[model samples]
Target: MLRKVLECRRCGYRTVCGRDDLVARLRIVGQLRRDKDPDESIVEALLAEYTPLMTCPGCKEVGLKANDADDEWDDDGDWQAAVLCEICRQPIDPERLEFLPETKRCTECQHKSETGTLPDEDPEFCSRCGALVELRVSRGSGITRYKRFCTGGCRGV
Candidate 1:
C-alpha cells in the first residue's frame, strides 16, 4: 500500500500518515480557526497542529517534506542498511528481514534475548588500544554522571 509520509530532511526521520488522517487533521485545524479564534491565521493554525509531526523525532529539527512511498519499500528502498540489530549493531539477515521487516534484533540476538541470556549492554572498545572500555562514575561535580574509561589504562593518549 502506498502512503504519504512526512520526512525530516536534516535527520531522516519519518512520520507516516494516511490520507483520511491528514484530511481530518486539516479539518480540525480549519474548524479551530473558524470557531475558536477568527484572529488566528490559517498558517498559525496549521503550524500549531502539525509542528510536532513536522519536527524530527531523532534530531528535534523542523522542516518535513511530504513523500508518497510503499509500505515495503519505505526509506528509499534501502532496506538492507536501514534495518539493523539493536543488540549487536549488525545488519539483520536478509531472509529474516524479508519475513519480519519490522524486527529490531537479528536471529542470534533474538534467541539470546528470548532465553534471558542477552547482555544488559554491549561492550565498548577503546579506539587507542582496541581493549574493552568500562563505564565509570565520576567523582567530581560534572555535567555527566558516568564516563567511559579504557580497561588497558591508556590514559588520555
Candidate 2:
C-alpha cells in the first residue's frame, strides 16, 4: 500500500496524505472517523474547486496550472481561442482558419461534399450553432455551386 505524506515547503509542520489514504482507511474501518478532534466529531469535507489565475508563469510570480495558461492576460502571454468549423462540429485551429475567407467550406466538409455529393442549390444553416450557411451557385455551361457560412453566428438572437 502506498502511504501519502504532505510536507509544507514554508512551515516545518508535516501532514499525512489526506485524500487517497484517508478514503482507503475509511473503506477498511466499518465506522467513519472524525477529521477533527476525537470529542469534536466534526468532518472536514474537501472537493474539487475552480481557481482562476491572472498571471503568466514564465514571468509572473504566482504559479499556474495547465489550463490556467488560457486565463493569463493577453499582454502577458498567448491567448488560447476556440475555433470550430461552422459546418462540422469538429475543432479547427484558429491559425489555419485565419486566412480562410468567411465564404469557404471547412476542409472536412469541403472534402466530404466534393467526394460524396454536391451540396443542394439552396443555402444551408449550421445545425449546431444555427449560423446561416450560404451556398453560391455559378451558372456555367453547367451548374457550379459554392458554399459559405453566415458572418454572424446562427444562434445569434
Best by lDDT: 1
- Model 2 Cα lDDT, one tens digit per residue, 32-88: 222323221111222111111212213433222222112133454453333444455
Model 1 TM-score, all chains together = 0.29
Clashing pairs in 1: none
Worst 10 residues of 1 by lDDT: 29-38
Off by over 4 Å in 1: 1-82, 121-157
- The TM-score obtained by model 2 is 0.25
Can you write out model 1's per-residue Cα lDDT over 67-150, one digit (the tens) per residue?
Answer: 555656564544433354666655578899899978888999999988999977445666676566787898887586987888
Q: Which candidate comes out best when scored by TM-score?
A: 1
Clash-forming residue pairs, model 2: 130-154, 131-154
TM-score of every model? 0.29, 0.25
In model 2, which runs have C-alpha deviations exceeding 4 angstroms?
1-76, 101-105, 116-157
**lDDT (0-100) at residue 39 of candidate 2?**
20
In candidate 1, how many Å is residue 60 off? Answer: 32
